[model samples]
Target: MRKNFLHFLIFIFVFCFSSFSKSETCGGADGLVCCNTITSTSGSVCAIPANNKYIFTLRRFGFENSAGEVTWVGTETSFNAALSSVGASMGNFISGQSLPEGTYVAVRPEVKLEMTVNGSGVSTSDSVACTSGGDQTENLATVMNNLSDPIPNCSSSPNEDCNTGDGYMRIRDTQLGNFTVTAATARTINFEFDVGSGVLFTASGGNCAFRSMGPLDVTMSFSN
Candidate 1:
């Protein structure tokens, strides 16, 4: 009897330990959704997809307005450079062009969108993250900041996406980093942003905008 009871107790301990050790995976509406700026290099929180579909967002670091917030004006142009900066392909990928508007733009039957940004210390910055789980999981491990290709307008709002809540973005699954998004589905994404005045670059602004180019949005997708 004593041996049997000890075995049973050990079994319970193992079972409980396994269950708790498992990282909680989120899905469905409340589970897999959207996210925003994440400053920790330790990796941000993300929803685990159920199947094949995945979604995410990215942005360039810039500052706008006296308060400094993320703006949309330089986003389209800078994201591409961000991708390449992380050592991704640049073939056929062009900036400044909008994703072709249409259906199937959803990319997969189920997708999860995640975006991320770094913090500026003093004041807390903001970010956004969302998931569309039916048969999908948020995979963000593949995403990385593009330090190479430079955006033309970034000089204006250097801290746009990172320092301020302006362009708040988030990473999907904290596991996957740096991902490639095709035009077919990419066109469907509607990125709405605000570009504050007197923050961008010009002949007079000179390198002021360049120094401001700090953080940007990192996007990624996952497979089944």
Candidate 2:
């Protein structure tokens, strides 16, 4: 009986140690999935897109109008181009779920913005700085037309917030301007879920913002 009890205790100790070791090696700078805080405006947490391509759903909060069903826009090599491909679905309801993993050959249908404002307002447009590939060279121009003035408010400098007209602003990736996104940004913007060492999804051109009534819910997906 004593020998059996000793063996049981040893097994428990080994199990506990193994679990603790796994937890320590699962997240943050030491590993991936850093468990950062997703916030308003693209930051370490919020702006950082999903690194790998996986099926996902988008949920919108506090929308004034009844959101239509999810739809697909088109697939471009990056965010700077236009509808390279289109899907066969469209509706007026929001709340997208269970998108399969693929190239998303169209504009994701559920580009809904959530906020508490009226009509439309300007949102601050800023580039997270990404690589100079594809349509990246025109990212800035895309931002100016799509997101600035008509979309989100822009600051003369980086340390400014978008006016968010009436507490509501819409933001989206454009195909105009471009920059080299940071490591964190690259990991998050997983359109293909297969970014090369120096490739990333860039926000530029006319996809910077959209017409909305509140803070935006830019839920994107990843593909291969």
Candidate 3:
């Protein structure tokens, strides 16, 4: 009986030690999922993305609409871009999710923007083209063109926040494909998920951006 009891105790110790070792591996710097805060803008993280699993669901593109605006963020869903060849690179991460470094075909979507404030406004547009063009506009544009809602009380930067006036915005549906992640000592690809029409925004020639809500904790990474 004493021998049996000793055997059991040894087994327990081995099991406990094994579990601790596994936790230490997963919680290390080269781990999969992380608790680090995903910032409002594109940045780096400690984990690789593809090593994780999904709590999958339909990620339909929709707007937060007025007071629901706080929910717009970049980390909830993943975006895919089809490249013509392996040499393609997405310039400046191409405005969304962390993609493997190399040359990417298209980064920013081609769209027009017209943001008007109390009186002043800005207008810009761009042609849609890739290594091949197939009209990616319907893929992710979240716009509220109706002038029905009462505009909010203005109190912010006119360029970044348009509290009143007619507004229009759209996101090109990202083409889905299997992408190659160039090997690195460490790298990250992130997408700007927070989107909107007339809140805090940035207007260039063909791209319009509002302040992002935030990013989720999952990442998609690949290796050599």
Residue 198 lDDT in model 1? 5
Native-vs-model 1 lDDT? 0.20
For model 3, state the Cα shift of residue 135 in Å.
8.2
Order candidates by TM-score, high to low: 1, 2, 3
Residue range 1-224, candidate 3, lDDT tens digits? 00000000012111010100011121123332221222213222222111111111122222222222312212223222111110122221122323323333222221223211110122222321101011112111133323243323234422232232222222322232233234432322332211111112233333333321111122112211
List the lowest-lDDT window of 10 residues for candidate 1. Answer: 1-10
TM-score of each: 0.17, 0.17, 0.16
Alpha-carbon runs more than 4 Å astray in model 2: 1-162, 175-221
Please provide, for model 1 over 51-169, each residue's C-alpha lDDT reduced to its tens digit, 9 standing for 90 to 100. Answer: 12111233331212222222221232222221212222111122332322222111111112233222111110132222221222222222222334322222354322122223333
Model 3 CA lDDT for position 185: 20
TM-score of 1: 0.17
Error of 1 at 37 (Å): 31
lDDT of 2 by residue, 41-104 (tens): 4332112111221112223211111132223322211121111110111111211222322222
Q: Give residue 155's error in model 3 in angstroms.
A: 4.8
Question: Number of the top candidate by TM-score?
Answer: 1
